[model samples]
Structures are given as structure tokens and as C-alpha cells.
Target: MLQFLHICNLALLDEVSLDFEAGFTAVTGETGAGKSVLLGALSMLAGNRVDKTIIRGGAEECIVEASLHVAGNKQLAELLDELELPPCEDGVLILRRSLHRKRGGKVQINGALATVTALQQLGEEWIDFHGPGEPQKLFHEKNQLALLDIFAKNSTALEAYQADFDQWRGLWREMENLRTAERLSPEEAEFLQSQINAINEVDPSDESIEQLERDFKRLDNARELGQLSEQAGEGAREAAQAASRVLRAARELAEIDPEADALAGRLDALIIEAEDLSSEYEALASGGDFDPSEAESIAQRMQTWLQIRRKYGPTTEAVRAKRDDLVRKIGSQTNVEGQLIKLEHRAGELEKSLRKQADELRRRRLKGAKDLAAQARELLTKLGFKKADFSIEVETENKLSRHGHSGCRFVFSPNAGQPLMPLNKIASSGETARVMLALKAVLAKADATALLVFDEVDANVGGEIGAAVGRELAALAGDHQVFCVTHLPQVAALARQHFLVEKGQDDSTTTVTICRIDEDKQRRESELARMLGDRDSKSARDHARQLMASV
Candidate 1:
């Protein structure tokens, strides 16, 4: 249940805080006193779209927030947990929405940033609004079926049906996609196959390309490299021979002087270094004799790698990746006929399974619709529509559809002689309200909507009928919080809590204010009398007093 609401800079409400409770709370005031604005605020809380223009003059934004106690709402708690939203700590769930001019708007649940879609899901679980525009919701086929299912307590069965339908839909999409993929055009097939054949011819390894290029370079310049190697080898041999002669002379002198011995040792080191250089030259010269035929083959292979790189990718790894993709794609298209046959058989099996499950679902709905019609008719009779005929038109299709096998239509007739037609075509907004009221009374225990707001449900209703509606709302409030905006004294007098919306203007600014009517008899009676249109009249006060006592 919604425990509190706060509004700021919205419409003509600069700032307002309302304390709400579980039971019938009547909101009444003169025409154009901003009661509807309060309902608008509630609608926003229910995740409806916001209009920034509703912001009050000179205000940058408008804010509306509500605190709900959700400890008892297992469905809501589970939904919150699933969405990874903030849980209702200590049973308190805070929801807030704000509209801004430049930045649009935002919704927050328990102070965590949230999406309006999440709030809409919450609305589905917690709030049900019935008013001027809401009765039309009952005319929708899905809504009609939902009401019947709620009455039947068939949510689990419906959940199973929905899950299977989702699977069937996904399978249907996959099969279609596979069929489309299996039959490629001739040109597409040729292009991909040609790429595959080319890739197969030159299976380049990522590790060998650079080494092959270096080998090709050396082989291609073989004549120059071999000559250079021979010249270096001869130069090292000559240097070693010359250094040995110098070392021999130095050693002979060293016998005569120790200084000569040090010079001989340096010459001996140069001769040893030259000999090592000659061995490296010989190794280099040996590589220069690589086979020309082998070199030509390597050159041809390098050309193929170059061509593959240009056509497929810059790197051998990239070519390999594309090669695998082409193989799979071409193979799938080439073998399409067999794949299609198998897929078609599987799809047929899934459809048959879906139809059988949907048949059971439809059977349950048809049985539940009977009880729903009977109970609605009974409740409407008590609400002053004794001759109204209510029925649920459940039409079961030959096969499963996107939603289900059967479609539900709510048909209604207010008078005995009238033909039963769609509720939207037959019922006025007032009659729609009564019909909704009857439905709510019947499904109260099965429904999980925590809040119900009625705007002008008393429209075109008076005296006895108005009192009946009030009693029904009060009774309905036994399970959920109910708020009714009205001009009738009977309904106003029945409120366990009463609030009056009043329009006032100071200078050029017009504002709407709401205040709770005190429990004192004089104050409550005075407000009821004002609603009666004669605050000071003795008869009006007496009538108000009588209405209060009846409650």
C-alpha cells in the first residue's frame, strides 16, 4: 500500500505532502480545484509518460514521490529482486519521478536510478487505476483474458504456456534464418568457393613468412653475396699470414729484450682474431651455393603469399581466419536442401507440442470465464444494474496463436432489451466504472494491485446509486487502498480519511492546495455540507450529519 506521497512544483501544487492509508479515502472539493492533478501525480507514479509543461511557472522541474510498504507484496518483492533494484528495507519502498525541461525526466526506486519500464512492471504488479480513461482497458482482448485468468487462479498455467510460446517463437525465427542462409545465389556461392580454393592452394603458416622473405633476399642476390664472402675470406687469410710473420720477428727480438716480448704477444692476439674471422667468412660463403631451382620455387610461393595477403588480409593469421569462415558459410549453403528438410520436421514437432499445451490453457480459460461472468453479473445487480448482462466471449482458434489458442472478449448489455456488445461499444464511462467495480469485487482476493484510484466514479450517479458505489469502494478497500475523487456527499461522508482540494490565487499566480479534514464533527460536517453546496444551510448540515451517521 502507498503510505505517503510528496509533490513539488507540479501543476499548481508548489509543494504538497499527503499521508495515505489502507481503506477508502475520499478526495473532494469544488470543480477545478486540482483533484485531477493529484490523480495525474498518481499516474506518473504508475509509470505513465510525463509532460514537462505540467511544471509550475518559473520552476525548473517537478517532483513526485511515494513510499510503499512492500513486505507483504511477495510478487513485488520478487520483481524488485529480479530487476536488481533496491529492496524494501524494513518494508518501505520509495519511488520517485522528476520531470525537467532540458533533461527530460528520471525515475528512481528506493533512491536507485531506474527506468520507466521497470516502474511500468511495478505498476503491473502493484497499481490498478479505474477512471474516465481506464475502463477502456477492459475492452482490450489481452486485458479481458488477464482478468479471467486472475479470477481462475491460473497464473502458473498461463506462465507455462507463455514460456513455451516464447520458445516456439524463437525456434520459428531460427528456422526461417536457416532457410534463408541455406540457399545462396549462384554468384555468392561462386565467389565464396573461389576464395576458399585460393586459400587452400597457399596454406601459409604465420611463423614462416618472415623467414622465407629473408631467405629469398639472400638467394636472389647470390652472385654478389658469394663474391663478397670470398673476398672477405682471402683478406682474413692474408691478414693472419702477415700478422704471424710480424709475431715471429717480435719473438726473435724478445729473446734480446723483455719489451720486445710484450709487442710479440699483441701480434699473436691479432693473428688469432684474423683466423676466427676467416672461419665466419667460410660459413657465409657456404650459404651462397643455394639451389637456383629451389630459389625459383620459393619465389613462386612468396608471390602466392603476397596475392593471398592482398585478397584476404595483410597477415597470414587474418587469411586463416577468413578461410575458416568461408568454409563454414559455403558448406552451409551447399548442403541447404538436407538442412531445410530436417529443420522443417523439427518445427512441425514444436508446433504440435505448442498446440497441445495451448489446448489445455484454453480449456482452463473457458471454464474460468464462466465463473467470472456469473459473479460480475451478480455484483453489477447489487450496484444498481439489475438488468445488465455480462459475458466473456472466449473463442478458441484451431491452432496456437502468438498469445494463445483462445481470445477473450468482454461483452456487456445494460438493459434487458439491449443486444450484448463489446464493453467499449455498450457501456458509458459510468457504467464502465460500475462494471469495473463489480469485477474488482469478484477478483479482489486473486488480484495483487496494491492501489486503486477512481476519478469521478460518482459521475452521473446520485443519492442511492452514489451511496451504493461508496459502499462497494469501502468494501473493496478491505483488500487494497482505495482513493475516490468525488463531488457526492454520501461518498465523502464514508471516508475514513477525507481531503479537500481547493484552488486559490494570490496576485497573478493560481495554486492548488490539499489539506486533510479534521476528525472533529463540526469540521467534517462542515466540509460535507460544503460539498452539498450549502455550507450554512440547516437542512444541508442535517443531511450531512445523517450521511456521516449512516457510515
Candidate 2:
């Protein structure tokens, strides 16, 4: 769960830090009280793109940082490993993001530098938000399928199907290439053969390409290499000889002097070392003698390789791969009919395999759909949508999807007599918000993110239903840390923690403050009473006190 969130220099918020625990926390404020500013900061932390204009006035950058206690979540840890991010220390995963006004922002995970993409992946795995633009994205088809997959624990099965899908796609591409080649005119076939023959003709027999390259490097720098080797060799030899001669002159004296004798022995060793070096240097200076004929042949062969590389490569291996592909295509063209038949058969077999996997996916989806609909109906009923009918319906197309041969849609109806229609067709934004909230309640256990955020979940809800919505959120808080930005007092009254985000202006500068309400009963009552449309009224206070007491 997210334990800490810190934001600095973002929009109306100059700086704010909040500590959270495993429960539903409600944020309430006036319309322009920077409530959305907090959500915006959270969005950036989730790896969503941000504009530089969001930086607080007079600040050059904005920063959002979070600390999550992800202990025992092997799945999240494994995901971090897959992204090559630093592992949690003592069950803590730290994510920090900094956005600059004049440059692109930077992301860090556990203090090790990371990419926005990495942060986004982590967000996808651990964060489920139902809010203005982002949270509702969960209603999309892909996310719907993923929710079902998560419920079914279908990672391994999905991976197997994806692998088969890739193979089928590859075969289809190859078959198309073959068919295209078969339709090539005689001149086109001749041109392809010519390109292939050009590479095959440059055979450096008895020598690998690497060996040729090494030889060429040596021969190319031979002059400079020889000069340096000879110069150093001669200098060392002359110095050794001169020292030896000097020691020889003292040899006679060495018979009487112990120092002279020792010095002369050192000179003898030095002279031998110098001679060995000179011999080695001589070989370096004059070796690798390339005959004129062999040099010409090598130069021509290199030119051929370079020509092919320039056209088809950034490297030798790439050109080589392309060469092999061209050869296969040419061969297929020669036996066009036979190759076509083989490819068609292979494609048919792959399709059959893909269909088998698709069947299994369809069956699992149907089962999951039934389970989700049952849960959805019960959850909606709790949230005051007693007549709501929800279903996850799996439908098919003639073609296959990357997900499978089928897709699913959320069918919903707020009234009993109305025919069930697609969620987008009949669901209003507020209805969508409530529906999403109910789903979040249903999937709380299946969702591993640990952090669930709902923005304006009471958009279309009234006091009659606000208590029910609050109860569902409170129930979800037991297993996850949930955050809700709401305007309704009934909803805010149930929060484990309540905060007021107030915006003020002084001398043309806007400031946003997030104040944790006092635990004093009077202070809590006052805040709730304000939400009830009175800050100092007997009737409003009584209503606010009652709402707070119910929780």
C-alpha cells in the first residue's frame, strides 16, 4: 500500500506531504480548492504525461514521490526484476519523478534511475484508479479482458496463446513473401539472383571473415607500426650496449670491489633482455608480408563486402542475414509451385493450432464472465442500483485478435425493462463512475495494486445512495488503501482520515493547502457540517454529527 506521498511546486500546490494507511481516505474541498491538483500530481506519479505549465509559479520543476510498503508481493517484486529496477529494501519500494520546465522529466525507482515506461508498467501492475480520464480507461475492451484474465489467473495460459499467435503471424508474413516472389516477372527474378550472386561470388576461401579483417587491419597500419617498433627497438639496444660497455670498464675494478661486480652482473641481464626485445621488434617491423597479388584479391573482396554492407547493412551480420533471406526467396521462386503448396499447408496447420487455443480462451472467458456478472449484480445492488443488470459478454469475429479470436464487452442496464446495451451506448459518465466503483469493490481482492483511487465517484449519486457507496468503499478499505475525492458529506463522513484542500490567493499568487482535519469531534463536525451546506448552523451540525456517528 502507498504509505507516503509528497508533492512539490505543482500548479497551485507549492508543497504537500501526506501519510496514509490501509483504509479509505476521503479528500473534500470547495470546487476550486485544488482537489484536482492532488489528483494531477498522483497521475504524474503513475507515469502519465504532464505539461510543463503545471509547475507552480516561479518554480522550475515539479516533483512527485511515493513510498509503498510492498512486502510479500512476490508478483510486484518479480515485475521490478523484469524491468531491471532495484529491489525493495525491507519491503519498501520508492518511486520518485521529477518534471522540468525546459527539459524532459526523469524517473527513479528505489533510487536507481528508471524510465517513464518502467514507472508506467509498475503503475499498471499495482495501481487501479477510477477517475476523470485515466481510471475510466479501465472500461476499455483490452482492460476488460485483462480484468477477466486476472480473475482467472491466466498469465501462463495467455502467454502460451500469445506465443502461438506470434508464430501464426510470422507464417502469414512468410507466405505472403513467397506469393509475392512467385508473381515476380522474369526480370525481377533475374535482378534478385544478381544481388545474391554478387555476395556469393566474394568467397575468401580457407579464411574466415574475421581473419581477413584482422589481416587487413595489420597491413593497413603496417608502416606506422613498423616505424615505432624499430625506433624503440634500436634505442633500447643502444642503451643496453652503452651500459654494458661502461660496466665492462669497471669489471677489472669489480674483482676488487663488490659493488662493481654486482653492477656488472645487472648489466649482463639487461643486455640479454634488450637483445630479446630487439629480436621481437624486428619481427613486428617486417612480418605480415602481403604479396601484391594477394593484396589485390583481398582489397577486391573487401570492396564487394563493403558494397553489400552499405546497401543492406549497418553491420556484417545484418548483411549476412539479408543474404540468406534473399537466397531462400530465390530458391522458392525456382520451385514456386512446390514451395507454395508447402507454405499453404504449414499456414493451415498453424491456423488449426491457433483455433484450438482460441477455443480454450473462449471457454475460460465465458466462465469468468458468468462469475463477474454475478459479482457485479450484487455489488451494484449494494450501491443502490437495484435494477442494474451487468454482464461480460464474449463475442467473436471472423479474424483473430492478439488477445484471442474473441473479444468481450460490458453490457449494462440501469432499468429492468430497458434492453441491455453496450456500456458506452447507454451509460452516463456518472453512471459509469458508479459502475466502475462497484467493479472495484468486487475486484478488490483480485487486484494486487493495493492502492485504489476514486475521483468524484459520487458524480451522479444522491444522499439516498451516498451511504451505500461509502459503505462499499469502507469495505474495500479493509484489504487495500483507498482514496476518494468526493463532494458528498455522507461519503466523507466514513473516511478513516479526512482532509480539506483549500485554495487561496494573496497578491495575485494562488496557493493550495491540504489540511488534515483535527481528530477533535467538534472540528470534524464543523467540516462535515460545512459539507452539509452550513459551517455554523444547528440543523446542519446535527445532520453532520449523525452521518459521522453512523460510520
Candidate 3:
């Protein structure tokens, strides 16, 4: 239940703080008294979308805040916990929304920054707003099925069935993909096979290709290389001969003079070095002969390698990778039949399971529908629709839906003589409002939420029926908080908490104000009379007093 609301700079409201309590509350005022503005501000607190234009002319921003006592709502507490929001102290949940003219808006739950989606989710758990021109969930077919499931308490069963159904659908999709792959034409298969064979015949290797390349270069320049080596040998031989002749003369001189032993030693060293050089030149000239046949063989092998490289890849390693990929693809194609068979079998089993579960769910739903129709009929009778006929039709579908194989349609006849038809087709706004109220009255016993707001629920209702509507709302307040915006005085008289919304204007500005009424029964009677009739009417005052007393 809402404990308090503080609003500032919102539309015609400059600043106001309202304290709320449990039970039925009513807001009553003349037309154009900013009643809708108050509701709009409250809606913002309940996480409705905000527009910056609602800010007062001189204000830079607008703020709407609410404090709720959520002691009895464990579901809402759990949701807050899931969002990692701060826990409520003394079971109080504080929600605040602020909108700025320049920057965007911000939302806070329990003083923690929260996204709009998170706030809206938490708000839904705490409050439900029924406003004019707003679509009603009960009238939607999907909502009708969900309501039946809730009434049956078959959520677990329904979830189990849906899980199997999803698995079945996934398997079916996989089977379709496999079938499509299998439908490839013979030309495509032949093309793939040719590519695989071509890659295999190349038999390329990185090390082998590198060695071939080196041999090809050497062989291609064989004539030049041989000439350079021959020139080098001739140079070494010429130098060796020149040194030998000089060493011989030096040795002879040394022999003739015994005092020249040091010079002779140097000559002996030079002789030895010249002999070693001569031997090296002889080895170089005598080394293996350069054969033109071997060179031709290397060139031929290189040409073969180049041909393969140009046709397949720029490098031998790239060709090898492509070959591996083709091999894997071929293997997959060869085993595709077996995989298809396995998937088909799995899909069949899942379909069986899905059908079994869906059938069981349909049975439970049928039973639940019977109970829901009976309850709705009873509730409608209490709301002054004495001869209204209501039924929940559960039609089985060939395929599985999220809510199993059953589709729910809530059929009704507003008058005694009329045949039953869909609620949307048969009921007027007034009849629909009453019907929705009656459903809410019944569902309230099962719904655990703390607050429910009805915006102008008295749209097309008046007279004694208005009092009955008030009575029903008052009864709902026994266990839940009810906020009703009404024009009918009979409904207003039943409110334990009464508020008056009055709009005032200055020279260039308009302001809306909400005032809590704390007056005597006589004063309330005078106000009710004003609501019922023009200010100067004795009969209207007497009638208003009677309406108040009756409530």
C-alpha cells in the first residue's frame, strides 16, 4: 500500500505532498479541476513514462516520489532483491522519479539508481492502473489463458510442456537444414569431388619445395659459377709458383753464408705456405664435374612445382591447408545420411513427449475453465448484471502454444435475451467496466499485490448502481488498497479517505492543488450535495444526505 506521495513542478501542480492510507480512497472535484493531472503524477510514481513538458513554466525539473509499505508483499520484495536494490526498512519501499527540461530523467528504487525498465517491473508488482482508453488485460485472449492457468495453479506443468515443445521445434529446424543440404544437385557434388582430387594429387610439402628452389637457382647459373671457380684456382696457382722461385733463391743464399740462418728460417716458412696453396688449387680443379644432365633434371622438377603452385596456392603450405579443409568437408558429406537419421529420430521422440504433456495441460485447463466461468457468473450477479451469462471456451489446437494446446476465449451476453458473444464484441464501456470490476473483485482474493488504481471507473455508471459500485470497491479495500477517481457522489461517499482536486489560475500561470478533507458529516453532506446538484438546491442536499447515509 502507498504511504505517501510528494510531487513538485508537475503540470499545474507546483508542490504538494500527500499522505495515503490503506482502504478505499476517492478523489472528487469539478471538471477541469486537474483531477487527471493528479492521476498523471501518481502514474509517474508507478513508473509510467514521463514528458519534460509537464514541468511547471518557471521550474527546471519535475519530481514525483512515493513511499510504500510492502510488508505483506513478499513477491515484490523478492523482485527488489533480484535487482540488487537495497531492502526496505520497516517494509517501506521508496520510489522516486525526476524529469528535467534539458537532461533526461532518472529513477531510484530504495535510493539506488535504477533503469526505467526495472522500475516499471517493480511497479507492476505493487500497483495496477485501470484508466480510460487503456486496454484491459482481462479482455485479451492471451491474458484470458494466463488467468485460467493461474486459477488452475498449473504453471509448473505448463512450463514443463513448453520446454519439450521448444526442443521439438529446434530438432525440426535441424532436420530441415539437413534435408536442404542433401538436396544438392549432381553437378555440385561432381564439382566438390574434382576440387578434392586436384588438391590431393599436388602432394605439396614446405621443406621439399624450398630445397627444390635452391637447386633450381644453382643449376640455372651453372656456366657462370664454373667459370668463376676456374679463375680462382688459376690465381692461386700463379701466386704459388712465384713464391716457390723466390724461396729457392733465398735457400741457396742461406747455404752459402752460415751467418744467414734467420733469413733461411723465414724462407723455409714461405716455401711451406706456397706448397699448401698449390695443393688447394689442385683440389679445386679436380673437384666433381658440373653435369648439364643433372642441371636439366633440377630445372624440370622446378617447372612441375611452379605449375602446381600457380593452379592451387601461392605457397606449398597454403595448398596443404586447403587440402585438409576439403578432406573434412568430404567426410562430413559422406556421413550426412547417418546424422540426418539420428536427428529425425530425436525429433520424433520430442514430438511424442510434447503431445503427451500438451494433452495433460489441456485437461487441467478445461477443468479450470469450468471453475472460472462459474466464479465470473456469480461475481457479475453481485455487480447488478443479474442475468449475465459468462463462459470460458477452451479450444484445442493442432499445434502446441506457449500455454499448451488450449486457446481461451471469454464469452458473455450483457442482456438476458441476447446470445453469448465475445466480451469485446458484446459489452459497452459501462458493461465492460462493471465486468472488469467484478473480475477484479474475484481475482483480488488470489492476487497478492497491495494496491489497485481505477481511473474514472465510474465513466458510464450512476444512480443506485453507482452506490453498488462503491460498495464493491469498499469491499475490495478489506484486503487491498483501492484508489478510485469518480464523479458520482454515491461512490465518493463510501471513501474512508477523501481528497478534493481544485485548479487555480494566476495572471499567467495555472496550478492544481490537492487537499485532504477532514470535516464533519454535515460538511461532507454539503460537499456531496454540491457534487450532486448546483449549489442552491434543498432537494439536492436532502438527496445527497440520503446517499451518504445509505453508503
Candidate 4:
């Protein structure tokens, strides 16, 4: 569960920190009081993208951090190990995110630097968010199928089907590529072959190309190099003679004065260096003589190498890669018919295997759909959907898809005698919210996420129905920590923990603050009374007290 949340320099929130526990926690505030700011903080913590404009005015960055108690979650432990993040100590995992104005943003897991993707992967295991917009996503068939799969516990089956499908798709693409190559015109084939032959004739390698370049330069500048070598050798010989003469003089002086021995040693070193320089110059002068016949051959080879580089690559490695690719394509063109027959046979066998696995998937979905609908219908009664008729229709298709050969749709009729139709076609936003809550209530145990967040899920619900929504949320809290952002006093009255968000401003800036009021009965009542329309009214407070007592 999320044990602590801290936000700094985020929008209207300069800084805020809250500690939470396992239970249904209600967050209540008037419109524009910055309740959404709290949701925004959680969203950023969940690895959602954020803009720099969300930073508080005059602030350089915004930060969101959370601490979770994950003592016995084996799944989270394995994920942490797989991502190479630091493991929990004494059942605590810390996640931190910071967004800067100019430097972008960064995510951290347990103090170890991590990517937003890693944070998201880990977040999925610990937190689940159901905001107002999330219910709309349920209208899509893909989301419906995914929910069914979760209920069915189809991980193993799905993995098997996906692997086989991936293999079949690869083989299919390869066969198509071969067919395309086989369809090339004679002119195209000739052009490709010419490119291949050019590279093959050169037989370029990194080391060989470098040596060829060096030899070409050396042979081309042979005459000029020979003249310079002679001049350098003459200069070195003269410098050596001069250093030798000075050393002899210094040696004579060293016999008279011992300090002069150091000078003689320095002159001796200079003479040795000059002699080595002269020897190198002499060697270069000798090698500078090149055979004309050899020079012509090297020049032609060098020109060919340059032309190949300009056409196919700016480097030898690129040239080699292009050559290999052309060769492979030509080979495929030559034996395309034979390879196509073999690949087609393999694809057929794999497609049969895929169909078999997909059949198993369809069977599981069919079974899971019935069970899910039955369970959800039972919960819908508790959420004030007394006569709601809900069912799932699994439609199987003839072709394979990324998911499977079957898709599922959520069919619903909100009232008795109403014709059942697709959820997106008939259900209102309020109905959708309640339906989603029912499904979530049914799947709470199957969901491993420790924290469940509902941002204004009771958007259009009020009065007794709101009370029922509160009860359902409270029930969900029996096993998971649940948070609801709501406006209903009845809902607020039932929370094990209640937080009040208030927007305040001094002359210079505005800020939103949230703090727990569950410990103060009068304060809780006052907040609930405010939600009832008038906090100062004695009657409202009395009603708030009564609501609290009933809960």
C-alpha cells in the first residue's frame, strides 16, 4: 500500500505530504479547491508524462515521491530483481520522480536511478488508477477482452499463443520478401549483380584498405620525398658533427672541473639523438625509390577502391555490408520458388498450431466471461444497479489477431425490460462508473495492486446511491487501500480515513493543502456538513452526525 506521498512545487501545491494506511480514504473539497492537484501528483508518481508548466510559479522543478510497504509481494520482489533495482528493506520501497524546467525529468526506484518505463512497470504492480476517463476505455473491445483474460488467469495460454503467432508472422514476412525479390525485372537484377561484382572484385577489408592508402601516398610522392629525405639527412649529419665537437671540448673541461662532466653527458645525448635522426632519414631516402610498374598497378587499385567507397559507402565496413546484402538478395532470387514452397509449408503447420492455441484461449474466455458476468451482476446490486442486466459476448473471428482469434464485448441493460446493447451505445457516464466499480469490486482479490485510486468515480451519483457507492468502496478497502475523490457527504461519512483539501492564498501566492480530519469528529462533521450545503447550519451538522452514526 502507498504509505506516504510528498509533493513539492507542483502547481498550486508548494509542498504537501500525507501519510496513508489500509482502508477507504475519502478526499473531499469544494470545486476548484485543488483536489485534482492531489490526483495530478499521483499521476506523475505513476509515470505519466508531465509538462513543465505544472511546476509551481517561480519554481524551477516539481517533484513527486511515494513510499510503499511491500513486505510479502513476491511479484514485486521478482520485478525489482529483474529490473536490477534495490530491493525493499523491512518492507519499504521508495519511488521518487522530479521534473525540471530545462533538464527534463528523472525517475528513481528505491533511490537507484531508473527510467520512467521501469517506474511504470513497477507502479502497475503496486497501484491502480480509475479516473473519470478510465471508464470510457472500457467501451473498447480490446479492453473488454483484457478484463476477461485477467478474470480467466490466462497468462500461460496467452504467452504460448503469442510465441507461436510471432514465429508464424516472421516466416510469412520472409516468404513475402523472397517473392518480391523473385519478381524483380532483368534490368534490376543486372544492376544489383553489377554492384555485387564491383565490391567482390575489390575484396575490401579495413586493414587492407588502410595499407593500400598508405602505399598509394608513398609511391605517388616518391620523388619529392626522396629529395626531402636527402636534405633532412644532411642537416642531421651536420648537427651530429657539431654536437660531437662540443662534447670533446666539454670532456676536456670535465677532466679539470668535475661539474663540467654533466655538460659533456648532455652533449653526448644530443649527438646520439642526431645520429638516430640521420639514420631514419637515410632509410627513408633509400626506400623512396619505387618501381614504375608496381606504382601503376597500385594507382589503378587505389582508384577502384575509392570509386567503390564513393558508390556504396564512406567506409570499408559499410561497403562489405552492402555487398553481403546484395549477395543474399540475389541468392534468394535464384532459389525463391524452392524456399517459398518450404516456407509456405512451415507457415501452414504453425498456423494450425496458432489456431489450436487460440481455440484454447477462446474456450477460457467463454468460461471466464460467464463467471465474470455472474459475479459482477451480484456486485451491481450492491452498487444500486438492482435490475441491471450485464453479460459478455465473445465473438470468434476467422483470422488471427495480436490478441487472439476472438474478441469480447460488454453487453448491458441498466434497467429491467430495457433491451441489452453494447455498453458504449447505451450506458450513461454514471452507469458506466457504477458498472466499472462493480467489476473492480469483483476483481479486487484477483488484482495484486495494493492501492486503488478512484478520482471522482462518483461524478454523477448522489444521495442514497452515493451512500451505496461509499459502501462498495469501503468493502473494497477490506482487502486493499482505496482512495476516492468525491463530493458526497454520505460517501465521506463512511471512510475509515477522511482528508479535506482547502485552497488558501495570501497576498503573494495561492496554495492547496490537505490534511487528515478523521481523528476529529467535530472537524469531520463540519466538513461533511459543508458538503451537505452549509457547514455553519446546526441542522446540517446534526444530519452529518447522524450519517456518521449510521455508517
TM-score of each: 0.80, 0.68, 0.67, 0.65
Per residue, candidate 4 scores C-alpha lDDT tens digits across 94-185 of 99999999896988899899999998788777777776544244667887788789889998899888988999999999987776654667
Q: Give each prediction's root-mean-square deviation over alpha carbons.
A: 4.8, 12.1, 7.5, 11.3
Residue 489 alpha-carbon offset, candidate 2, angstroms: 3.0
Ranking by lDDT: 4, 1, 2, 3
Worst 10 residues of 1 by lDDT: 131-140
Kindly report which residue stretches of model 4 are placed more than 4 angstroms away from their true locations once superposed.
70-92, 100-106, 112-125, 133-140, 177-339, 412-429, 505-509, 533-543, 549-551
Cα deviation of 246, candidate 4, in Å: 57
What TM-score does model 4 achieve against the real structure? 0.65
Per-candidate clashes, comma-separated: 0, 1, 0, 0
**Residue range 472-493, candidate 2, lDDT tens digits:** 8898898788889998998999
lDDT of each: 0.84, 0.82, 0.79, 0.87
* Candidate that scores best on lDDT: 4
Worst 10 residues of 2 by lDDT: 202-211
RMSD of 4: 11.3
Off by over 4 Å in 3: 47-52, 71-92, 112-115, 176-334, 416-428, 505-509, 518-525, 532-551
| Candidate 3 local Cα displacement, residue 89, angstroms | 5.9
Question: Which segments of model 2 are wrong by more than 4 Å?
Answer: 71-91, 100-106, 112-118, 152-157, 181-340, 416-421, 425-427, 504-510, 518-521, 538-549
